[model samples]
Structures are given as structure tokens and as C-alpha cells.
Target: MINRISAVFLFLFFTLNASFAQQVLTFKGELAPIGDRVEILTDSNSTMSLRSALSSKEFKRSSGSQFPNLGTTPYSYWIRFTLKNESNSKAMGIQLTQSMMDYVDFYQVQGDSVTRTNFTGHRRPFNNRFVKHQTYIYQVPIIKGESQTIYLKVKSGKQLTLPIYVGSIEEVVENAMIIDLLFGIYLGIIMVMLLYNLFIYFSIRDITYLYYVSYLGIVMLTQASMQGYIFRFILPAYPEIADMFIYISTSLIGIAAIEFSKHFLSSKQYTPLLHRISYIFWALYGIQISLAIAGFHNFSYTMMLALAMVSAVYVLYMAVVIMLKGFRPAKFFLIAWTGFIFCVIIYVLKDFDLIFHYNNITNFTLLIGSAFEAIMLSFALADKINILKVEKEQSQLETLKALQENERIIKEQNVVLEARVIERTSELHEANEELNSTLENLKQTQSQLVESEKMASLGQLTAGIAHEINNPINFVTSNINPLKRDIDILLAALDEIEIVGLSDSTISAKQLRIKEYKEELDFDYLKVEINQLVKGINEGASRTAEIVKGLRVFSRLDEDDLKKADINQCLDSTMIIANNQLNNNIKVIMEYGELPLVECYAGKLNQVFLNIIINGIHAIHTKFGSTSGGELKIATYADEENVFINIYDNGIGMGPETQKKIFEPFFTTKDVGEGTGLGMSIAYNTIKKHKGQISVMSSPGEGSQFSLQIPIHNNQSLSHLN
Candidate 1:
């Protein structure tokens, strides 16, 4: 009785455990997600054999709706299930969707005996499999109403994901063909984007396109490595190399994505701190590459996927940050990466089992996302071309606008110039008419001038004779009466002495009378006075002779060349000629300094001096009105290079407004008709023609000082110098 009870209890316990261990799948000629009726068994050491897994009961059932996503587990994961084929299919197709798993061992069991076994994986040589395909696939024979027990031993250095598909072989191939078609389209898109960007890159020579193109190529290689295309086609003999490329390509794709975005978004310029941090990540990616190459593939793959997730987040973060900072291109970059990042997140979450998962979602997630991202980024590059086009048009428009503005301003100035010319012409016409009328009147009075050139007589002869001879003539007249009076007194004294001498008187008496008469007449004083009178007459005549000499000296004014002359002498001659204008009320102060002879037109310079002195005399007259307190101070000073003359007058000085226009033609402080206003203008021109300058300083209540300077030996272009 005790043996019976123990057997029953053990049997009951085994039944419950077997029923609870896994669910059975009834195949109906359609794809079945392997997770629906699968038991997942794990071994930490990856040393669990098929016999051990079948004997041990340490297994876990999977949720039916999703694949068993065991993220990054390496080696020794076992999945076992039972299948009942109800449809008319001879074979059940088992597809392990992930291609990079190092080994996959499939077993078909018949009532505790191993009927058949197939061994294949990405790490094994390509021909070792019963069926040569990208993913690990197995064909197990089944019949209607008969059940098949299956086992799959999976091992990888990357993520340990068992995304299995159970269906008829025909259905499996159809699904694979569908996948190939999709991959072809994706590859076509990537190649098209590459070519399109390449065209733009050559057209504009933008480095951003190069970075993005290289990124697309690496992304294509990464997907190819992950899908076993590289191992199948490129390096069939090198399974180990094909296995390593997945991690290397994973790490490189991350690095490449970062580099591409860094340039494409202008991250360094817009986000300086983040740009620096990106260099730190570059170093981390270096470590990742080292890990992948050094055969630490499990850690490397885990780190790579984690880093890829983080990298996607980081780049997306940078894009969002720079977009808010008003980077225009970043907005479009954000849109592209947002989609890519979304798919990457889903793909990663599926591996990590963070979200509710499915088998087909994993493969489709990144495909759709990456394709969409690549296409949109291509459109973004196209938009950049459009932006450049718009900017060019804007620049052209701005240039045209500036030209129009300049033309408008020039037109206005031309209009103003035309108006001014018309007004000036009218004024000239009126002045010419007045001049002609005056000429006619002068012609009517021509006989009175006796045909002596009127302008020449007035401008030259009158100016010359009046400025040259008046002083000598005045000297003669001033001394004539005094000389006459002195002579008469001396003659009277001589007569008295002669009478004294002729008288018949004794010698002592005559001597006494002569001495007495000399005392009485003051004859000694008379002698002195006679000598002084003769000296005065001589000086007057000498001055007249000097006047004649100066006329000869000044006659060269008609010559066309310059002459060397003394500036002080020029001033003195002007004063002498202007003597009649001077009265006792006006005191002339000479402050002459030692001066060098200057090369100049003496006649013209003389005229300048006359004009200035005459103006000063008038200024003094205006101030004192024939009184004796007015002063005309003339000063001359020199250096080795040039001579300087200053004429100052304590007169009714001009205001600022008058001084500004003082040298202008037809400008004068004098009442109209009393002055022609041409004197100072002509004087200024003469000074300028000598390569010289003239300036004035004055205030209304103070005084006026006019300074003139000229070089000592300048004989250059006198006309243009003005």
C-alpha cells in the first residue's frame, strides 16, 4: 500500500509539472510565433546539454504574444516546444530570425529517442547547415494527429534573442522573399540618397554632404552585418570575421552617426559645451571599438547597443537644444533624428524587454525608421539647396536695390545742378546786359578818355603812378616852404655881414661890429639851419629819384615770369603810394624783421599790398573818422624758406559772417558802389598763385589782422595751385 501511494503521488506531481511547463501549438499552415508554446531554459555556464535540459525542470514559460527577448545573454539558452500540424504540410519550418548568433543546435525527438539533429550558426562555416540561408532555419517532418517535440540551442556573443517563426517551408520562404524585397527597396533608397547627396556635394562642395554620405554607407554596412548579408555574400569563408563585423559595425555606425550630426547641425558653433562633450563620447566610442576588436564581444555588443541608445539620445538632445537656440538647420535635423531615435528606442526596448514585445516589430522597427530617416534627411539636404537658391536671389535683389538708390540720388543731384545752372545763367545774362549797357555808355564818352586804354589807365597807370610818385611829390612840397624861409633868413644875415665888411671903419671896429652883428643875427644858428634846409631839399629830390627807379623796377610786372624781390620793400612802396590817404589821425606802425628775397610776381604782389593797406586805411577811417588815435600796424617776418607779412588795423572790424565772405568775389563790407569787392578777391588769387596762403582774424569790437605767406623760390604751376 505504501509503494502504491508513493507511485501515484509522484505520477500526479509529474503530470501537473509537465502540463504547467509549456503550451502546445496546433499549426495550421500559417506562421506561429515561437513564444506561444515555448519553454525557455538558461544555463549560466553555457554547458547545458540537450539531455540535461530535457531532464531538468528549471524552465520558464513565455507570454504568448511576444518573442522571448533576453537582451544580451550569451551562450547556453535553450528553447523547447511541442507542435501539432493540422494542415496538409509535410515539414515544419523553424526560423531563428537573428542572424549573428554564433551557434544554433536543432533537435527533433520521437518518444525519448533522437530522430534527427541539425547544427548551424553564424560562427560556423556556411555549408555546414542542411539548408544554406541567412537566418538559421530547420525543417522538421510532422504528420496530421502526430505531435513533434523540438529543441533549439542558441548561443551568441551579441544579444540572445529567440525570435522564432514556425510555419510551412513555403510560407517561410514567402516571408523571406517579402523581407528581401523590402531590403532591396531600402538599399535602393540609401543608394539613391547617396547619389543625390553626392551630386549636391559636388555641385556646392559642402562637407556636410560627405559626412552624411559616409554615415549612410556605414549604416548600410551595419544593417548588412546584422542581417548576415555580408557573411553570406562577401566573406563566406570567413565566418569569424563576419561575426566580428556586427559589433565593429555597430560601434562604427554610432561613431559615424555622431560625426555626421556634429557637422550637419553645426553643433560646435551652436552648442559649444555639447560639442566638447561629443569629443568625450568619441573617446568612449574608441574604447567600444577596442572592446569589439579585442574579442570582448558580449561586453562590447552590450556596450555598443547601450551606447547606441545613449548616442541616439545624445544627438537628439543636441538637435533639440540647438533648434531652440535658433539654428534653422537643426530643426530639420531634429525631425530626421526624431524618427530614427524613436525606432532605435523601440528596438532597444524590445531587446531589454522594457515594453510589450513582438517578433515582427523588431525587424520592421529599425527598417521603417532608418528608411524614413534617410529619406527625410535627403529632403533636408534638398531644402538646403533651395535655401541657397533663395539666398542668392535675395543677394541679387539687394544689389539691384542699392543700385536703384544710387541712381535715384544721382538723378536728384542732376536736377539740382540743372536748376542752379539755369539760375546762374539768368544772373549772368542780366549782368552781361548791364555790362553791355555800360560799355555803350563808355563808348559814348570815349572821346573824353582820348583813346588811352581806359581799363589799363585806371587799373595799371593810375594805381602805379598814385602808389609810386605821391610820396616823393608830397616830400618835395612839405619841405619847399621851410627851405625857402631858412634861405631868406640866411641871405639877410649875409647881407648884414657884407655891409659891415664894406664900411670904411678901423679893423678893430669892423671886427667888433662883425662879432656883434653875428651875435645879433644869431648867424651860427643860421648856418646850421641853412645846411638842414639843403639836406631836406636833397632828400626830397632823392626820394623822387627813388620813385622813378621803383617805376622801372615795377615795370616788369608786365613780364610773364617771376622775379626776386624784398617783401618789406613791397610794403614800404605800398605805404608810400598810399600816403595821401593817411592823415595825422592815422599812425602807421612798422614792425619789420630781417627778410630774405622771395621769388614772386612783384607787380601782382605790389597790388596785393596796396589793396590790403588801402583796406586798412579805410578800416581806420571808419573807426576814428579823421581822428589821430587810429593805427595801421604792418609787420614782416621771415625764415630761411619763406617770407611772412601781417597787416593789422585797429578799425571797425568785421563780424564772423563778413570775415567768412571777405575774400569772396563780389563780397564786401563796404557800402554798395563805394567798393567793387574785387580787390580782396584778386589779392587772394594772386597769393594762392604764388603757392601761398592768406588768413584773417578779427572780432567786431576788437581789430582785424590779415596774414600772408609765400614760399621764397616757388615757380611751379601757379594756375593750378590756386
Candidate 2:
């Protein structure tokens, strides 16, 4: 009777225990977010024992989000959840969505004993995880009728984001595959953008493209590191390196982005204050990197956040300023950076727990923002060409209007002069002096206008000249600081040697001190650098001299008369002067045949060459642009009758109608002020004075060639009289 009662009691005890424990959260067929059903316990000191945690009833139900925003802390969190196999399957998998946690410990609990199920963390070697993936995945055993209670311990130097999912093996595989495919598509888009921008950079040599590509590349790397792709696929054994790379890439992205903004918006030209602020952000990025290297991650992260905010704001401000000043591309720039700034603000808020935590939003913010910005900015860059085209058209229209007005004024003046002449014919002697003075004043006014127009045309070359000279000067200037530091180091070492000799130390001790000082100074490194510094200075000087020589040759200021000159030399000098205007995309070919020295005004010949070469450059740029290929050919030959010189370009050629009017005064294919409508006319007149002929042969889409035939020597009468 007693045994029967005991057996009945045991049966009741087992039944009650099963009923209480088997209240499980089930994963049907899909991976599920372990939501508020889980219980969370905060171990504020990070020293809670598993026995104490399981025994204590302090765990509270989690909030609704799959991932909690705990901010940055040194505390550990203990999470407990119950799962049962509602399906027929006997196996299931658990996955941790957070990839950046420093230490994660999973345990399976049974009666009075806890067994570690899996361990993973960013601080641990990536290969030590239960499953090799960007996400921490662990296998769990499931029985048809039994329940399992799981416990998790998570702690990190970074913000704590705990998102866990449970699913069948097939479901896990499917989810992973879906994620990888999405990432693949995302990365593929980034790569295509990188390549496209690089191609543009190569085609135009725009510094803006260079900066944008670098910024995008660094941003891609940062996103990849954050998502654990680098740790999973690239450095499985070095999660620490992956973590470090995240901070470093973040810092570099700020720098590149600011540089891109500066160039794209022309901040230096339009917003000087914002441009200076950009430099401050660059310095902040540097400091952030240094802090990361020193292992002050929290400080570095804060710095990174600040740098990003400052840079984004500066870019936006500069874009706004440029747009207000009538820059069309700035409109798109403003929109692109707005998306990026919004993402950054949201992510930062989320990190600090100022906003609700959403796993997908926080994790994918940068990726989404970068992708959107890159695409938008690319469109913006492409739209820049259209803006330039519109501006060019506007300029042409204004020039045409100015020319028409000037012609009307001239015609009115001519009518007045005719009327005055007819009226004054009866008093011819009395009016002669007044007419001469009026004519003289008119000549002076015309000369002043011509000079003003010529100055305006030449002023375009000034910036290019400054750019050419500044490079070599910058090279020299950049080296001076390092050279100075190195020299100071050497001198300090020399003074230390003298102090050692004057000291009362023994010979061996003195020798030891000298050796130590030399090593500390990196004596061998300094020695080599000194030589490099000198070599660099010399090269810089030589480059500067070459630029000066090119300038002198182009000007021909000292030799203005009709002197024996090499036409080939004249062409070379003209090319140097026009080098800044020539499309980098075009190649120039020189073909010179034997020719005698042609006696002509060196300055005038230089002017003719300048006009023709500049025109060739403009034509090539208009046709093939800065992306397509083009060639300009200059060939010189001589026959017994004349010296034949040809300037040709494989560019948009003119038709017979345009060619017929090319040499007429105030006639031009270019914008009115752009050409002065006098270049070719002046060339024709100069050739005529030299007893030479100038002509052009052109057809639509076929290329234009301007040919000049000059006598080996000018007429003695014209030469002497002039």
C-alpha cells in the first residue's frame, strides 16, 4: 500500500514538472526573431555566475524589439529562453544576429547542471565559433516531447545588441543564402560604381572623381567589416584586425568624403569658411585613427561620430552656398548628402539608445546610405556636363547680342559721319582739323577696345600657368619641413656626441651612450632620407626651370621683328602656351619635313600658331570630348615655290559654307567674345603682308586642315618699310 502511494506521488511530480517546463517558443518553418518571450537579466558588474543567474528569479521579460539598444557598457547580460520541437524534426539551430559582440557564451540548462553549448565573440578567433559564418550560429538538440532551456551571456566593449533567431536546419540555410545573395548584389553595385568613377577619373583626371571613388571604397570596406564579411571570409583567425579595420575605414571615409565635397562643390572658391571647416574634420579623422590604434575605442568611436557630423554638415552647407550662386550640380549634391547625413544621425541616435532599436535599420543604414549617395552623386557628376553645355549656350547668346548691338552702333556712327561730311563740304578747310581730331579719338577708342578684348582672352591662361608652377613649388615646399626636422635631428645628435666627450664617463660607457642615441635617432634612416630630400629639391628646381623656359619660349617678347625663325620652333612654343587648354584626352603628332628658315615676325607667327592650336584643341574637345579619343597633327613641308605648313585636327570639321566665311572680319564659328572673330582674319592679313596665302579645306565629320604657304623670305620692300 505504501509503494503504490509513492509511485503515484512520483507520477504526479513528473507530470507537474513537464507541464510547467514545456511552455516553449517554437520555430515553425522560418527563422524567427526571438522577441519579448525571452527573459533578460542584467549583470551590472559582469561577474554573475551561471548557477546564481539560473537560481535567481530576477530576469524580466524583454522589451518588444528583437535587438535591445544597451548603449556602450562593460556590463554582462544574461538571457534565458525555452524552446520545444513542435514539429517532427529532432534538430534545430540558434543564431545570433549581432556580429560585433566581444564575448558571447551560450549554455544549456538541465536539472542542477549547466553545460556550455557554444562560444563566440569578436575578441575570440573567428574560427572558434560553432558555425563558420558572419552571424554566430549554434546547433541545438530538439526532442519531440521534451523541452530545453537556453541561457546566453553577452558582453562587449562596444554597444550591446542582442538579436537571436531560431530555426530548422533548412530554414537556417535558406536565410543565410538569402542574406549572402543580397550582400552580393549590394557589393556588386558598389564595385560597378567604383569602376565607373575610376574610368571617369582616368578620362578627365578630375580630382573630384578620385576622391569620390576612394570614399566609396572605404565606405564599402567599413560596411563589410561591420557585417562581419571581412572576419568571416577574409580573416577568420583575426577578428581583432577586422575590428580595427572598422574604425580605420570609418576615419578614412570621413577624410575622403570631405575632400570629395571640397572639389565637387568648389568649396574653396564658393565657401571659404566651409572649406576651412573641412580641414578641421580631416584633422579630427586623423586623431580618431590615432586613438583607435592606441586602443581607446570608445573615444575613437565618439570622434568618428563627430567627424562624420561635421563633414556632412560642411558638405551640405557648401552645396547650398554653391546652389545659391547658380551652380546646378550642387542641387544634386545637396540631395545625395542629405540621405547620408540622415543615416548617420539615425545610426548615432540608435547607438546611444535615444531612438528605438531596430536590427535591420541600424545594421544596414550605412550600406543603404552609401549606395544611394554613390548612385545619386554619379548622376550629379554626369549632370555637370549638361550644366556646362547650358552655360556655354548662354554665353554664346550674350556674345551674339553684344556683337549685333555693336554693329548697329557702328552703322549709326557711319551715317552721322556721312551727313557731317556732306554738310561741311562747303567749309572744307575749316572742318579739316576738327575731323582729323575726331578720327584720331575714334582710332584710340577702337584700339582700347581691341586691347581689352585681347586681355580678356589671354586671362584664361593665367590660372593654368599658376597651376603648372604651383605643383613644383608645392613639391619643394612640402619637402622643406621634413628636411628641416631631419637636419635638426642630426644636429641634436652631433651635440649629444660632444656632451658625451665632455662628460666624466669611461670610454665604454661613452661608446654605449653614443650607440643608444644613434639608434634612438634612427641614424641610418635619416642618412638615406637626407639624400632623398636633396634629390627631391633638385628635381623640383628643375621642374620649375622647365616651366619658366616654356613660358619664355611662348612669349618671344625679346624677338618681335621679322627674323629668320624655325617654323617648327614656333609651333613648339605655341603648343607650350596652349598646353593648358588642350584636352588631356587628345594626342598631338608632329610631322616636320625639311624646310628653310622662314623670315617672318616671330611674335606674329607665334600668335597665328596660338590661334590655330587653341582652335584645334577647342574643336577636338567639342567633338570627342574629354572622354573620347582625338588627335591633332602639325606638319610642315617646303616646295621650291613656298614653305607649306599645315595645322590639322581629327575633330568636328566645318562645311564649305562655314569655311567660306572663316576669314571674314567679325565672323566666327565660336562664341562672339570667345573668338573675337578676328583670329583667322588677322592670320589672313598677316600672311598677305608676308606675301603668303592661307586657306582651309574642311567637310562635315571629315576633319579640318588649315594650310599656309609662305615664301622662304618676305618681300624686301615690305620688310624694310614695315
Candidate 3:
């Protein structure tokens, strides 16, 4: 009886093992399709969470190679499949074909416990996936005799099409490579189109190529992001931005496409109503992109869909209108847009679950459609170019005919024109002489005007220098009388001492007489007074010396040729010379850095510094209008190869338009006769002559910065050393 019972137990174990084996799908060299084994449950209300889904017995069994087509629905799907390892391969992975699902959750069930393996989606960061890849790939751990049940929950705003494949790691990698190769081929086509049209645009300066390139590039990027290539490769670190990019890029592509169509077919000329509709679609696209970038993604996506549909209808309408108007380019445009529209319709319908769904086809229909449209549009653009060439040739022929007709008319009137030629020759001679005289006079006047301007500038500088000189000179002149008086008093005291020594007087008498003389002369007061006078003289002399030095630097008498110029010294000299302008309200702040000697024309550079400084002072005064003032900061620094001078001012800054034209001759902000506008222009030229650059940054109400960059070691530096 015991032997019979043991035999029945062994038989039951073998029978169950055989049944499990039959249920498992095995593969050796290729992938195993897991879709056929999938039993799906639809959660219409999304009430079945992952925990409930794992234990739920309400799931319906379905057998197919893919999930049922449920386009753009709110229903959540739970897919159940049993995986078993009947082979020796331990390295196996399962990949879900749909990459753009917003949420995908994978669960592994062992006995009574359910383990949530991964919760990742396209909406989350791409790196958060258990296996970082373009698609959701999960590792399956199944021993040779063990079976594992797995569940995937998918929910998205898009249509649900899940195609599952289980394979070894090597096979999975091979499949990825194949898919990448296809994407590469598609992207290559897009890139070629973009670059080809871009080159055409540059070669011929055609707006059509410009519009086409923009449209193609936007479309390519949109498709790439939508298909997960952009997320996987381009912006993996910024997965949150990827969704926003999709909507924006898609909308922008619509704008570019409409703009391209408007220009390519001359819609404004051929079809006015269609042209206006294109503008409406363009505005709609702009609004969608704006909202998407501003973090209104859901609304943006909804609006984008609406715009895309409207754009498609407009494209078809424009194409028809242009064709009705007998435009040759319209046919290609019509064909290209028709193909694209058909694909978009199918894609949208599939998303809405209103059509039969093929996973790869529905996923890449836009890309495929765009590729077709781009190729056709390229042909259309080429045809348009050819048509323009023919038109140009015809125009040239007509011009030639008109010229030949005029030539015959002239030949017929040649006898009558002989008399007029004689009269016109005399008039030409008089006009030539008058023009010559006027030219000479104008040259002299211009020379005189320039000389007068220079003299006027010199006169103003002289007046300022004279004012600076007069102060110290006046101090010295006024102190001389007091100094002389103190010297006389000291001399008188010395004479009294000598007399006392020479005369026959007692020591007490001598002391009494000397004390009386000292008290009479106020000798102690004279001593202190003399010292103060001497100090005053010394200070006055030093002030005079400083003034002279500043003048010398301003004149640049020692800088006849290129010299090793200290930029900080130049700034100091300029400040000193322009003190009359900056002395009162405008404060000059110098932040000097350790610098190498810069080789430059010192005198011209000084002039540049003076001009900018004076301008800065004027700017401050204008901004404050005698009420308050601002600071002028001058900083000097040097790098390994170049020296930099930065002058910044907190004043009424210039607008962008003014900044752009600041270095242009006769461009100034000062009132009519106050500014020559040549100061900055001349400064720019002088800096450029020394192989340097001058740039300005300014914005109204903020302030302005003028930066000068000059090379530390130039050809002139070497020559000057020699």
C-alpha cells in the first residue's frame, strides 16, 4: 500500500511539471513574443492600484501579439504574463515596444507576496528607469525549473499599444542596434534635407530654402523627442523638459511650415483668403508654443492638437487654391501636404482609438510622413528655382528686345541729335569748370573747418590748464610778503645778539637787553610764523610740480613713438587733465590691477582716455541735471597676452540703438552743437590701429561699461625695445 501511494505522488508531480513546461515559451537564438501569453484587465476608473491589480481576479484573458487598441482613453491597463526559464540562459530581458507611455509599472509575484520591481515612465526622468534605455526593459529572474508571473500597468494620454518581447541580453542588444539603425537612417534623411536646403539658402539667398530648413529641423526634433531618441540621447538629464520640447517643437514646425508654404507658392499673390488663414494658423502655433514653454503643458498640448488639425486643413486649402490659380509649384506642394495630412489623420485616429493600430506604424507614422513630405517639398523647391530661372531668362530676352528697339530709334534720330550734341558740349565745359572751382573751394573750407575745431578744443584745454595753474601761483605770490617779513624780524634779532657780544656790557645787562629786543620783535611768534610760511611755499611748489607733470603726460611730449605705456598712469593723467569737468559732482574711482607695460601710441591713447572720461562726466551731468551725481569707475588689468581697461559709469545709459551706432561718425547723444560725435569714433579707430578692441555695454537706466582690450606684446613692443 505504501509503494502504491508513493507511485501516485510521483506521477502527480511529473504531470504538473509537464503542464508548467508546456505553458512556458522557450527561445534559443531569437526573441520570444510574450504578447500571446498576456491577459489584460481594463480599469476604466483607474481605481485598481498596483497592489489591488496584483491580487485582482477580475482580469480577462486575451491572446494576441499586442494590446488591444484603446486610443487616447482614460482607462488604465494591467497586463499579466507568466514567464518561465526552461533553458540554461540566465541573462534575459523583457522589452516593451511602446516607449512614450506616460506611466509604466512592473510587478513580480512570488507565492503570496507581490514585489513592485519598477515604476518608471516617459514623464519621469529617463535615468530613473531600472534599465536606462529608450524603451522600458525589465530583468527576469527565472531558474530552469521555476516559473514567474509578471504584471505591467500602463496609463497614458496617448493610445495604448504594447508589444512585448523576451530575449537574452545579446539578442536584446541586437534588436536595439537594428532599431537604432532604422532611426539613424530616418534621421540621416532629415539631416541631409536640412543641410541641403540650408546650403541652398546660403548659395542663392532664397527665403524658401530658409523656411524649408527651419520647418524640417523643427519637425525632425519634434519627431525625435516624441519617439524617445531625444530623451535617450539629447536631453536625458532634462527629462522634464522633454515633454515641453515636444509640444513646442511640434507647434513651431507648424509655424515654419505655414511660413514656408506662404512664401513657396506666393500665397499672398495667388490666394488671398488662404494666405490670411495661414497667418491665423501661424498665430495659433505661436500661442501653443508660448504656453508650453511657460509651463502650461496640458493646455498647450490640447491647443497644439487643435492647431495642427487646423494647419493641415489650411495646407490642403492653400494647395488647392494655388493649383486653381494655375501655379506650377502648387502640384508638388499639394502632393506633399496631402501625404503628410493623411499620415497625421491616421496617427490622430489611432491615438483616439478610432482605427486599427499597428505599434511601429502608429508610433512612427508622423516621421515617415514627414520624410515623404520633405522629399517631395525638396523636389518642389527645386522646381520652383528652375521656374524662376526660366522667368529671369524671359525677362532678359525682353530687356534685350527693348534695348534693340531703342537703338534703332536712336539711329533714326542721329542726324537731328548732332546739332544738340554741339550745344550740350559747350554747356558741359561750363559745368565742368564750375564743378572744379566748387570742389577746390569745398576742400579749403573743410580744411579750415577742421583747423578751427582743433583750435577751439585747444582754447578750452588752455583755459582749464590756466585755471589749474593760477591757484598754486596765487598761493605762492600771496605767501612771499609774509615770508619776507619773518626773515627781517629774524635778521633784526641776530643783529641785536651780535651787538651785545661786541659791546662792553655785563652778562646781566646783555641778558636784559636781549630779552627786551626779543619781546619787542615778538621773536617766538616770528619763529612759528616763518615755519608756517615755509610749509605753505613747499606745498604750493609741490602743487605746481603736480600740475606740470599732469600737463607733460597729457601732451605726451616724451611719447614720440611707440612706448611701454602704463595704462593706469594714462588714466591718472587723463583724470587730472579732465579735473575741471569731473572735479565737482562726478567722482572718479580707480581700481588698478598689477599690469605689464603695454606697447601703444601713448599720446593717441591719452586722447582716447580723455575723450571717454570727459564723455562720462558729461553723461553724469546730463543724467543728474545739476541735482545729484554718479560714479565713474576705471579699472586696469592685464592677462598673459593682453591688457584690459574697463571704464564704467552709473549714469543715464544708452539704448541699444545708440550703443550700436556709438562708434559711428557723427553719431552722438548730446544736444545739437554740444557734441561732435567724433570722440568715440576716433577712439575706436585709435584702439584698432594699435591692434586692440573697444566694446560697450549699456542699457537705459542701468549704466554703461566701455572695455578696451590691447595686446601686451605686439610688433611695436619688440620694435620699441630694439
lDDT of 2 at 204: 81
lDDT of each: 0.79, 0.78, 0.77
TM-score of each: 0.53, 0.52, 0.53
lDDT of 2 at 372: 87
lDDT tens digits by residue: candidate 3, 583-611: 57677788999998887777778888887
Question: What tens digits encode model 1's per-residue C-alpha lDDT throughout 1-722?
Answer: 33443333233223335534566788988886666568878888989876577676887776554567666765578888888889899888887777888988877765535666777788888877766778777787898777777878888888777778899988877777777787788888888988888888888999989998999999889888888889888988889988888877887888889989988888888988888888877788889879878878788877877898999999999999988987777878889999999999888777677864646766668777888899989888777777778989999999999999999999989989999999999999999999999998986664343222224223534655665566657767777887788778778877877897899998899899989887887878877877776777677789788776665554444556666788888777666566667865788899999988988888678778877887888888988896688888998898888889999998888898998999987687878656667778778888988889999999886779999998998857455311
User: lDDT, candidate 2, residue 460?
Assistant: 66
Residue pairs clashing, model 3: 71-353
When summed lDDT is taken over every stretch of 10 residues in candidate 2, the lowest stretch is 7-16
Runs off by more than 4 Å, candidate 3: 1-37, 43-47, 62-65, 86-88, 286-306, 418-722
In model 1, residue pairs whose N, Cα or C atoms come closer than 3 Å (at least 3 residues apart or on different chains), thus clashing, are 467-577, 585-627, 585-628
- Clash count in backbone of candidate 3: 1
TM-score between model 1 and native: 0.53
Looking at model 2, residue 528 earns an lDDT score of 98
List the pairs of residues colliding in candidate 2: none
